[model samples]
Target: MSRIYRHPTQPTVELPPVDLLTLLFDSEHSLAQDDTILHQEAANPSNTVNKRQLRDLVERIAHGLRTNYGIGAQGPNKDVVTVISYGQMLVSAAFFGVIAAGGVYSAASPSSTVAEPARQVKIGNSRLLICGKEHQAVTTRAAEECGLPLSSVLLLESSPEWKLRSLEGGIDVVSSSRLSWQTITDRQALKDSLITILWSSGTTGLPKGVMLSHENLVAETYITALSGRQWAAKEIEKGNELPAVQYRTLGHLPISHIAGLFGYLLAPMYSGGSVVWMRKYNWEDMLKCLKQYEITAFYTVPSIFLRISKSPEVTDHFKHLVGASTGAAPMDGKLQMAANAKLGSGQDAMIGQTWGLSETTGAITMMPKGESDTTGSISPILPSVELRMVDDDFNDVESGQEGELLVRSPLVTNGYYNNPQATKDAFHDGWFCTGDIGSLRDGKFYIVDRKKELLKYKGLQVAPAEIENVLFTHPQIKEAAVVGVPAPDDPGTDWPRAYVVPVGPDAVSEDDVKAWVADRLAPYKQLRGGVMFVDGELPKNAIGKFLRRELRDRAKREMGIKAKL
Candidate 1:
């Protein structure tokens, strides 16, 4: 059987073909009747940019990029400018401005250490870095290492000495509008021109520069707005309506991320909703923001959901919330149910859950507004997207069987920047290999695990997520990860081991933990390899996905054998 997904609206509708800037600020697309697009939380007291203010600000920055740096003077050249900051008011402006000026900006996480950001600067070959004061030292050092002058570093703050104002003061509308910003020759030019480069979270290895075009982003924004899986629409359907209440977004994730860029930022902007910013995330602060903003839609990762779903504060604090989404990592059926039960009501209320990679822009599969899904099952594929489940030889798998996900569409990225070999390896025929294991049933998709991350124990493949899901059911367990370690006595065979972070200071015996699982699973599936406990949180990437490879290496070191990971 062949499985392909098409959006409900795909047949009659097509995404507008224009540059990202035109899509964002054009009068035709503005959803805001009041011209508001950003909502600054008290946590970020000094930042707010409405649609008009934001447009002027982006235009001003676009003018500066052209006049000072001549970034686009050569006509759609790949002069990369790096933006490293949290979701500041102007970071949005900088993002659109760089593209508006015909230069592409790469989004780097503020959580990046010296080596990571430095490698990005080198790979991007960035001529200038737009950053914040918080990561000043690391970025400055990275710029130096990349042989870029200190003057190439631009801060995200106001500088009267330099005649530049923070987005905080707002830009001069007249002066900004006067600047003749560069424009593409045609819609085709805009569609093909590069707009932004975002880094892939290097779970397996080094992060690659994923280049996305104006058409790619514009399509993603439009599809999200039209998609029934979009959380904001679900919120209204759940009876959270109020008089003159604008749809608002609460985002604590880095705006530089694809999820942050699309689901949390651009889609909301495209829909004429305001985004409330959070500089950093904590469960307690998240609870406070829910009430303070009466935030209708919330998009976050499963780790945060795990903590909050189990917290006493969820039902009480999240009453005003219309919908909740888990991203960055997959949520198990058990945890997904708990989250939906708390966040949802009747047959609806819970919204958002789909999957995408940097290659597919943001989300490629989303649940329609009127539907619900199983714990691990994500919604059907988007209408504008085409996908397949293929076996090791690239032959199509049966619909109900697991295989690597291969996707094709305008939503797919061109390839990694400056790496032709990697670009070639990432594609087969016209399809981009997703590196994820998945299966389809009734148009819904289930992500089994990463192909490379699957563990072999006693000739059977074990998904770490499967064991981790069971661990989550244990009330004493706060977080858990499973990895296969080489049997100490035999290098050829492997056995499963679990690393856990307990909820509190209370002691949990290893044997007791092993016994709890022994009765639940087959003897081979038991934790016969043993259990190890960590005093702190497990190592994770910026988006909260577990770095399981790191855990395997740690287990190798502890056992005093050079175990192959």
Candidate 2:
């Protein structure tokens, strides 16, 4: 029997059938028109975009894309536009513009190599490529490699002036041309409409594109926002003076991921807040911006919080921060409490931990406002999200017993793009298998283990199979298995380590292997955990499958982590 768990406190609300773009700009839930929605962290007055201006820009870019590139000419969700760019205010424009033009927005990391973006382009069947000025060279190369025309590659610029022009000088986004987005109200259409594609490495294999729909985005945004509003209302009723939490956050993380996509782009618009765009992440600059912009709320990963807890540079910078949450990886309880102490100016500014994946469209569990849990739990099950902890046989585990966590929610992604088998494997009956082992106790959820082997480095997904495939390309490497070893300094993050069996003894050094990987893969996917050369064949099962658990346990033992694998 299925023992599905629902939020004990929060009531589930019926979600309205509406598209994401219309909900953000046209619907009753839209922000105030005159308010600033996007801000520059560099303190440039001209670099900001208000809600009114943003709407207009979205329309103009949409029109330009449709007119020049024929994006969305065949209808929505058919044309995929790939964007690989640094964090900037105009990136939001490109995102909405693509969606508004009826194109599926596909995000690729700016740190990605030529081959990575090329592969994504091929997989997505991308009609056009959009990138920032900084990544123009790589984007151009990827576009060429993928057989995409140079005219189809658009350069999104924000420094001297806001412009979206083609690298080959054929297309230009003009302010006069405006194309209104279709306001979708049909429930089935909303559920099926693919707006974005965020990549994720499931339990195994290379990165697959997680297809998110309008329904997924709308449900997630509404449910998350409703949770906060309810908590604020209760605080008001209790006659407790609530600290004003103006939803201003720094966009320092990669917008390619779901965390940055929802937190920076979608959430701020719904909350009538501003997102200060940081061109790229820099520790010192981030701290300075936090104090300078008086940032009130932000969502980040545990690695950043780890730095905040131990870094001497962190002082009153987080004073104005009233709301903060961490996700993408597990956070230590001690580090969470320590980081909380530096926030809210002696008020209740707890660093809540969220639990979810790109497949769930960001977070499935979020700690409500004015609440603090120091037990390392991922708060309660989010409203409208049903969770089930089950054993290997698909039978429900006993209450409070840890098992593989499966979720059923409107926020969950439809499936992986262009991959039917993967999509089928991702679900069990109607539930989306989370691949995370966790338990529900006293209405709070705690992640005990990961069923999946994907490595997270500073909130970015790094597939071990992708790294292993790169390693296999080397003639000197015979048999290679990649596993995530916990980073010594940074909590809640892992480094991709390779255990290799050489073709010949002493044929390749560790530095040679590391250098080889660094040249091929992205910076984050490099073997920062160091490569280990095995004497013979790796531990394997009777079927000749690699015993990743045993190697993972060995890796943990070497790292001084006493936790059982």
Q: What is the C-alpha lDDT profile of model 1 across 301-418, one tens digit per residue? A: 8877777766766765666666567666667787787666677352453745778888899788876665666556767677778888899999889878889999888889889999
Q: What tens-digit string does per-residue lDDT give for candidate 2 at 1-565?
A: 6787888865477887889988988788755466665556365745788888888889999999999888899999899999988888888889999999999999987667898889899999998999999889999999889888898899898777888998896568745779999999999999988999988732245679999999999998888888777877888899988776677888888888888889988998888888898888777888988888888887876556655765668889988777788877566465577677777774564788999988999898888766778867887778889989998789999878768899998888999999999899989998999888777777678775466766889997776756765676576776677899888789989998899988778999999999989998899999988899998677743213356778888897877754444
TM-score of each: 0.90, 0.80
Backbone clash total, candidate 2: 0
* Model 2 weakest 10-residue run by lDDT: 539-548
RMSD from true fold, candidate 1: 4.1
Using TM-score as the measure, the top candidate is: 1
Q: What stretches of model 2 exceed 4 Å from their correct place?
A: 41-46, 201-204, 235-242, 346-349, 453-565
Q: Return the TM-score for candidate 2, rounded to 2 decimals.
A: 0.80
- lDDT assessment of candidate 1: 0.74
TM-score of 1: 0.90
Candidate 2 Cα lDDT to native: 0.82
Record all residue pairs in model 2 with backbone atoms less than 3 Å apart, i.e. clashing: none
